[model samples]
Target: MYRFLFAIDKEISYSDLKTLLKKGSGIVVDVRSKDEVDKGRISGSIHIPVENVESDMSLDSAEFKSKFGVAKPSLDSSELIFHCQLGRRGAAATEKARSLGFKNSRNYAGGYKEWSEKEGK
Candidate 1:
């Protein structure tokens, strides 16, 4: 059920992401490493490095909760967005999240670089 919905690849633009952020409508995940995130990141985004994303892990798994400190979004959540330093990692993370049953997950293609430079993060 959930898998069918998220099977499609979706990309979110920076502007749309800003709107979503202001609305507080979804979860934003940063897929950068700790060192990169320690430098700076999008406000309100959860830190989950790409390496930590297990392809076989389910969103409801205890391991996922322990790692992110939040319950995984239900299959219907369209607000699950992922980003990274440049975008590649974020895309990978999005794929992982989808594989984990987050069918509505999306990748912020502009990433932190574009977000900070253009949006003055």
Candidate 2:
């Protein structure tokens, strides 16, 4: 079990997100639903809908380790960026990610809605 005292509301710009996605240095977890994703997404974001986070709302770290069945290096943090339709769900997902021990997690405040509006996509 973990507790989070600080909350994240990192307002990520669309251009910045594009840069990161190009770098492929981390994973972009879409916290939105499948329908939302089908509409359009950040090209390569991994869809892990916020509603199906986990049984206890945890990242699938332990499951990954077990399934791989190897002495894989324990993750200190997952370079995760979460987004949703608007900023609200992203903020909530950020809090949940922090509680689940994801240190480098961030909330893309300018989520899909902002991105779409900005790009006219």
Best by TM-score: 1
Off by over 4 Å in 2: 1-11, 54-78
State the lDDT of candidate 2 residue by residue for 2-120, as single tens digits. 99676433556677777777786656768899899999987667676786654323425576446433222223434467899887888787777666666557788889988788777
Mark the 10 consecutive residues where model 2 has the least summed lDDT: 68-77
Worst 10 residues of 1 by lDDT: 1-10
RMSD of 2: 6.3
- Please write out the lDDT profile of model 1 over residues 1-121, one tens digit for every residue: 3554324457899888999999977888888989988989898888877877654235455766777666677766888898998889988888887877777889999999999899666
Question: Which residue runs does candidate 1 get wrong by more than 4 Å?
Answer: 1-9, 55-69
* Clash count, one per candidate: 1, 0
Residue 90 C-alpha lDDT in model 1: 86
TM-score of each: 0.81, 0.70
Structure candidate 1, residue pairs in collision: 6-103
